[model samples]
Target: MDLHYEVLGQGKPIVMIHGGGADSRDWPYLAPLLAKHYKVITFDSRGCGQSPSQTEAANYIMDVLNLLNHLSIEKTVIIGHSIGGQIATEFALSYPQYLQELVLVAPALAGFVHSLDLLESFQAIQSAAPDVSKMTELVVNSPFCSVIKDSTHSKLMRVMTEHNIRKMFEWAAFGAVWPKPPAIERLHEISTRTLFIRGTRDHEDSVKIETHFRAVPNIQFVAVAGGDHMLNLTHPEELYMNIVTFLGEPNKQA
Candidate 1:
């Protein structure tokens, strides 16, 4: 298949979507813990990890839909990080009937325009381009990610970042297609039981997005103390605990 995925454990299903510049490998530390309590599914989105690149326009929300249908997962919790969180948000908005809960960790807003400074920083990273090491350094060494720079997960983060950068060189003609009207303006429309998470050391722009998400009618927000954008790697135990608490009773398949 074009998307490489794996399922573990046995309980209510939870589909974990990794952020940009990462793949299912992003969930190694946290996935196992979650697997102990729920059926966990992790996958490499197109062009990341083992997934093949696509030449046509891609709708990640649809990708999530197709994955669920292929697995015969009629209902599942969606936990998404970074860009993956953005996809999860749109998915919840589009198909609330299919999700038991929605969790977003530092997700990007579909219609949001980042500040000029952040845009420039991203551009600078892109300018490094073919220099994979430099681009990876720019991403990992940034303030929002620096907490992991000295942690044991640093090596893994570097590897994932570099692998993601290299994958860009292999991209075919592909354009991401997000649903219209943007999730930012439609936050009030989402009625799913939602959990929003972010780290204390997260970027300023992420804070702005949180303000928009407050419009979500039924949502809870948690700030991981001393956590960074990559809290999943640096604070998996804490992350898992918060999730389980939010999930409450273990899901049962009747």
Candidate 2:
């Protein structure tokens, strides 16, 4: 209930979870478009944007469930990007009855081991520590994110990354809590229809993640040409279209 959330046009509910180092601000171009068709809910996950930093171990999956309960949303479609996608995946596996559909964009897997290159890049940023400027630069220039470098939204991406990085300093040392065994081990357990989307210009790891998602019973894959990990910001229209088709919803001009 303490999370900062926004609600858009009314219809079947659609929860939008932004990626790590990002908040709902990434959806300015996509939410309204999706809102035209269904009620869109966007929120700042704990320790990001306006959401409060956690003193206790963070359970992102529970945070999501609490948000849905607080809003009285019993069942809804979930659209998550990057780390957000990981959370959505676990939630769908743990509480399949609460989901109608799922959409993942350049998602990080729950149990899959990420590349050493990625782990080192993340560590480098953290090593920069309280040097907010250096952390922001490292993140913006990181391979998984370099796709945003030339876009007009690069400044926006930088600002959001900086905001989330600064908030990290306020969080406790406690690590985030995820479901047991992890979603990667249970991809076959997913019951809702799923749409997996990754950009052509994204990192090599994203390409690898796609191969793992083949276990899902009802799922579709999309490769966005020229899109990157930040597709929510750079390719909202494309994301929206793919989501519409996957959900079997009418394609509005949005």
Candidate 3:
């Protein structure tokens, strides 16, 4: 599927991918900071924001590659959040030639066994299908909001939640159809410079996934103090600084 994307500035390219229930807008506070040093691209993944709904699951990886191909970006830095981070990991594994560097913010890895409570929460949300108001409420109260200390950031998240609730539910329902192999064992295969960032207060599953990458030689992990799953929104400055520093390193580029 052709994605809705925006390209800004010039120099080494940086592609930003948002997590589930979000779109390109998630980078408004950070993209510009990075754009000052490199060309930056942000887009709505398939079935989110302005992008069209998708029938097939796990097509996000390809959709991102296709977007790069469409823009003639052969090699660039890739930054992904949550599920977007999962796609970036898959992309690095599948097409290492196209990456310059990788930054995963609270990325969700494939094959990491989720806790029963987490699974149950998801099932509960799924079972409450078509209840947009309830879903919106649940999302607003989710761990995604834990680190949103700023009122402005809180409002922004709420707005995004309202806008994407229906589509979020739709995407969640398609999850059962796209089971992927575990990526933990393949981390060593990724030679690209990769940085993993997670919040101190983020979900347990997200925090725990970092442990699996401890043995991966090319990965660097950092924890944001007092941050949450929505660190990009709640702590954009710190996130932006870490990204700029990582990408700016002379020897880090692939």
Q: Name the best candidate (by lDDT).
A: 2
Clashes (N, CA, C under 3 Å) per candidate: 0, 0, 0
After TM-score superposition, what is the CA distance of residue 47 in candidate 3 from its true location, in Å?
A: 0.7
* Worst 10-residue lDDT window, candidate 2: 245-254
Where is model 3 poorest over a 10-residue stretch in terms of lDDT?
172-181
Candidate 1 residue lDDT tens string, 215-251 = 9999999999988889999899989998998998665
User: Could you tell me the TM-score of candidate 1?
Assistant: 0.96
Residue 197 in model 2: shift from native, Å? 0.4
Error of 2 at 26 (Å): 2.2
lDDT of 3 by residue, 1-254 (tens): 36788998878889999987788878888898887778899999877788777666647777878988988989999999988898888888888999989999999887778888777766776677688767666666665556673446877776776677767655633542222455777877887989999989988888689988775678888898988888888788899888878777523432
Q: What is candidate 3's local distance difference test score? A: 0.79
Q: Which parts of model 1 have CA positions greater than 4 angstroms off?
A: 251-254
Q: Model 3: residues >4 Å from true position, as ranges?
A: 149-151, 168-180, 249-254
lDDT of 2 by residue, 1-254 (tens): 99999999988889999999889897989999989889999999988899999888889999999999999998999998999999999999988888989999999998888789988999999899899999999998888876787888889999999998888888885589998898888999898999999999998899888999999999999999898889788898998898888887544422
Itemize residue pairs with steric clashes in candidate 3.
Answer: none
* C-alpha positional error of residue 51 in candidate 3 after TM-score superposition, expressed in Å: 0.9
